[model samples]
Target chain A: MAEKIATREAYGETLRELGHRLDKIVVLDADLSTSTRTALFAEKFPLRFFNLGISEADMIGTAAGLAASGYIPFVSTFGVFATGRVYDQVRNSVAYTNLNVKIAASHTGLTVGEDGASHQTLEDIALMRVLPNMTVIVPADARQTACAVEAAVEHKGPVYLRLGRSKVPQVIPPGLPFEPGKAQILREGQDLAFVATGIMVGIALQAAEMLDQEGLQAAVINMHTIKPLDRELLAETARKTGAIVTAEEHSIIGGLGGAVAEALAEDYPVPLLRVGVKDVFGESGSPQALLDKFGLTADNLAAAGKRAFQKKKG
Target chain B: MPAISAATLEELRLKARQLRREIITMIYRAGSGHPGGALSVLDILVILYYKVMQIDPHNCRDPQRDRLVLSKGHACPALYAVLADRGFFPAHHLKTLRKLGSILQGHPDMRKTPGVEMSTGSLGQGLSAANGMALAARLEKARRRVYVILGDGEIQEGQIWEAALTAAHYRLDNVIAFLDYNGLQIDGWHRDVKSLAPIVEKWQSFGWHTLEVDGHDYASLLEAIRRAQMNKGAPTMIIAHTIKGKGVSFMENQINWHGRAPNEEEYTRALAELEN
Candidate 1:
């Protein structure tokens, strides 16, 4: 039976584990402790935690300095503030110099609930993934978010880990080996493929089941690492299933949709349908209501998969 | 604790003169570099790299070694010259500055260049980076200190104050920042462009241990740095007053020379004046 786990909870647990093991791992937050779930780490290790007010740029710059001095600094904030607010600091102090800092951003995409568009970061993955030497990870659920946080600490360079705010259903089992630049094939089918990332992974899995009822077998692959993007898995899946539907909670431009298009355009050209927020801002609503309003639900994924299949048939 | 020897101070002054000449030569070779700020900061760079900072070029990556960040990065020609002269790299590589595939890039690249502590060019950022280093050093119980040089014009950025508040909030006594108060920026005089007057009062008000000194006076600069190292509970700021173009008569205090390398005739005159 698949258990439902919130990525933020997993992150909190994983941080506590890492904190106990590694004495040099310090956690810094921009006053969004409960929201980002860094309070878990703070509770266990009071001396190591630093609450840097609401200054995102200072948090990143400080992390860079800490990384320089041989400590692995995990700076957490909301996805919108972490990426959009302090982009220059991250670019200059972290990515440009290749510092060993991990930015764990929570409340990403429309799943952030009533906080709405200003809080939601639909373009974070696009912004972070485009920077050289920056590893971008979007875990499927809480369990996977924990796994991704652990993996990011071990990775040698800067990483941007995107997590959702709402309680998401955990599709991946606990103790599963999570590695960077590798994709997890949740289910295998031949007729069509539902490629997804982040919280949309569970939605893609549900959509696969719905498509199965319609006599179309839809394969599901969780492309967590957006930059090193599992090109081999995508290429082989495209060869097997003549169509692909990339589902993400980000903008269609320069995101998972764009990554899939770039991979397929070069290796294997397939009929691709991007299921994401069009060029529009989100609004104040519940997580489920916003998912429906933005066409990011499992039903939307099924529709997009069916449309992609029909285009392949033509 | 006492004053530095007179002979040693004179030797450092001569070395600063030589460093200014090297800055001119490198910029002239590149045909494009920030000469005004580089010349202005030559004395401060000479004193820190040669006499003040506890560092070794041979063991450049020594964890316990003192760190220096050139926050006023447009003036990197002088730093590149001084580091090369210190044997961080071969002195000959100075000629390849600003060229394709050269380690001597327009700005300092910490990865490419030895003895360059942090990669900085964007203003109002290096001090914040230094604060992190200081905080980390404290966390690890390390005794190494951090120094950052900022441009007077660069202090106009808001992020500098953000870093200022942070450094004070953290009480990072292990960090000391130097402001190259040459009074001129790329556009015009700093007073005309964006006045950072009462700069000492500003730093003092921000809770930093503040000191004002003639940047060209190696002894006073060294004493100020010593006082900063001895002080505890807050970071220190040394507001270094200097001439924009220190050694060259024609380029002295001229804002046009901020980014421009001297032509053949001017370079010849500048080199002769330095030799004399």
Candidate 2:
């Protein structure tokens, strides 16, 4: 076990460090600079940063305008406001024309505890991935968050980068290379495959260790890029393991689970179990309590792996 | 005030009339497009394209060029007519308004249409985008300007105020907007619906350089734009008062014409009126 760091903190540090190198990079936040960590960039580049005062729709539209004028704009806000509150602006202004705008959303999923369902965005991944010309990325840890941000800057198009509020363990080694739509296979197995994203990647890897003790060799995968999904990796992993379990800190309907299922159902049909929030709204609770209540724990994922394995055997 | 000669004003008026006729024919051909708002905003578009805006059809993508955003995109028939007349595309394409696979879509799409700066159909968004362009111009230290046209009814969306505050906060003097104050909307009169009365005052209070003018009058529109450019450190808003359907005798100020195409006889009658 190593020290934990929040992905949002990593994003802030990365943006500030990159701000000095990239002059064309402009950042906008909806009065959430302190919370979203855009304040770090704002402090360095005061002229390039725009604080749009709690108006998400206007913030998105303004970012679209900035992008249209040949500046790469990274818009920062809470996940719920960035996607649901301002969905039309993102769709029409940004995604429709495929502008070079990056929507970096923090405080996503059930881990945004105490704010409850209103603040927690469990469906942002589905909302964003459904749009054409949108790249969806959910980094597993602080190191990966930095990679995702830098990648988003280089990748020219609309991207939805999901970040978290809670501190999570360092799952990936520092400075691991990150490609836009590639998934990383962290652990190898044979009986079943555990596909996870965001915070759930660490949980899935822990669950793999638990399953390994029971003579069940479950492969663990970190599927960070949900859109332009690493279909080749998923297809190969699904074929190798007859059963699959998908884990995410989001709703099972349209989040990581849904994306994996769509791919597996299309390429190779396998007995699969989706581990996530079961289409129910989250309530105010501690992050650990919410994870335990919503069946997003390592133990829950291991159980799901066994269920998928048994179903495949049956 | 730069004295626009009577000859220039009259020529603009005739050109606007011809464009108005084109708008009628385009909507009539399309069979299902907005005609009232199109006609209401025709003269403003005409003046900007022909006289006010510094744009060349040959070098439209030039970085230093002035940009125009038709925020009230339902009025795109007017914009399309002007763009065609300016030789951005063939005038024959005017007949293909709203046609399948035609560049002229129901709403303004920048990717589809030439000389269109920003793709806007939903209201209350253009100003923020215009602000972005203005900011970009400022950042680049270019003398280019960004102009946007918004409908009175479209201002009901809350995003407009957000943009207003942003433009003033950023001191985007390079951006200018025209609020097409045509009384009619799709449902009814804007006064009876969501009244934006004390509108100029609202913008002035929001730290904009506000002006009022007759939208149909070419000279007045140009003069207002001149004043807007001189007022530095704040974005300008020209509340140009206009009739719903200005050229056609029958459709003038009529609410029903807001979204309906003229019938065959109505089209013939409208054309005859514009010609007169």
Candidate 3:
């Protein structure tokens, strides 16, 4: 098994190192510094770190003010509070104002586990991507999360960096440069392609290995940036593979699956299957149990690929 | 705080009345806007732009200039009139209020309008932004102050209390805020809908230095601002008691005029009443 690191852990670590180079970076958290790993940065830059104390809306609005004052603020909190609880603040104060606020939300999707549906955030992507000036990113591994942190700080305007609590296999190389709106292809195949994001990328890579043994070649592409959907790359990959399956640990209504489906429908129509949580709420369980229950595994991904194979364009 | 000279007081009173006329006429042309709140808050804005804030129209982007966030953004017609009068842009731009492609949006948009700090319309978010500006000032070792204007009804939002705690927790003394207590909202009287009585006590308990004053009186407002500026540890909240639709006789204290533009006859009468 590959070594694993939680993207949230990597994010906190990345901000710690990046803080040395970037003097303008200020950190804000809504009483979740320990869980979200923002404590790492707070420990180093005590004056620069502001613990806003369970006020998500206030945290976001304050970050916007700092951004207006020429400071790049990275606000950290759980995914639910970061997106739903402070939606209007994020919409009006941050995104609409076009301020440079980085909302690094941790513990996303069913993998948040045992916290149940209330704490788990399966709709953060849908919420963040719908805003006009918001950029949404889902880094698949620790190395990718570090790159994404640098990219989000350097890129102006609002950015929502979705992160997770559980550690996942490291698929991205440490030396590779990452940019928003660009897609990374991990494996190239022709029979079917799996477009995955966040932890699902590692799952998709494992599924491709499973499919290779069964005489079906599957390609794994990481659609890390959800908002700018890399339409050219998605179209080309779809054309080459003929069928595609989008996987995410989120609701199928509007996430990586929904974005890919929307882009493909407009630019390139193809037979596609979305492998994600169907229209249902999650429940309290261990991370592994929840993954197995939601069919978020290599076996389930390989099955989704086979199903896409049967979905011929009639 | 020292007493204002008779000349300065008379000048400020006359200037406020002129801006009231502009606010009424601009909304009447747009055919729709929040006249009541705009009129109620116009005097407070007059004092800030005319005397307190250090701003230059030519160098509007100066980082040292004191910032103001209109938390109650529906009152932007008043702000636009003041911004234009201050030469942030051409005075003729006030005629283009609410029109398509106009820099003056229905709400205050910083990206569109000059001299506007943080783009604000949604209630209960301004105090946090002000706290942010104050924090940034403290970080940079700059002495710039940040002012915010909020509506009485707007404080009903939970985020306001959330931000109230933030300002106090951070000790953002540079953040000075005013609550335009016109006693009316879109639905009806604030007391009848949801009372914020004991409002001063609320801010006091929240770790702010609170002052209650007459909204329209220039002396009382200026005194409160002076005391607030001298305050050292906490943000100050000035509860300026005002009548809804203050300047116009028919509109004064009338909830019916909360969001409507004036008709021709009402416009004529309004302009006549404010005429010297």
DockQ of each: 0.74, 0.82, 0.90
Cα displacement (Å) at residue B177, model 3? 0.8
Off-target runs (Cα >4 Å) in candidate 1 are A1-3
Ranking by lDDT: 3, 2, 1
TM-score of each: 0.98, 0.98, 0.99
The interface RMSD values of the models, given in order, are 1.0, 0.7, 0.6
Chain B vs. true chain B: TM-score for each candidate?
0.98, 0.98, 0.98
Candidate 3 lands at a TM-score of 0.99
RMSD of each: 1.3, 1.2, 1.0
Q: Which wins on lDDT, candidate 1 or candidate 3?
A: 3
**Which docking class does model 1 fall in?**
medium
TM-score of chain A of 3: 0.98
Output the worst ten-in-a-row residue range by lDDT, candidate 1 chain B: B116-125
By DockQ, the best candidate is 3
Work out how many backbone clashes candidate 3 has.
0
Model 3, residue B203: distance off in Å is 0.8
Instruction: Encode model 1's per-residue lDDT on B161-235: one tens digit a residue.
Output: 878888998899999989999888878877888888788899999999999999999889999999999999999
Separate clash counts for every candidate = 2, 0, 0
Q: Best candidate, lDDT-wise?
A: 3
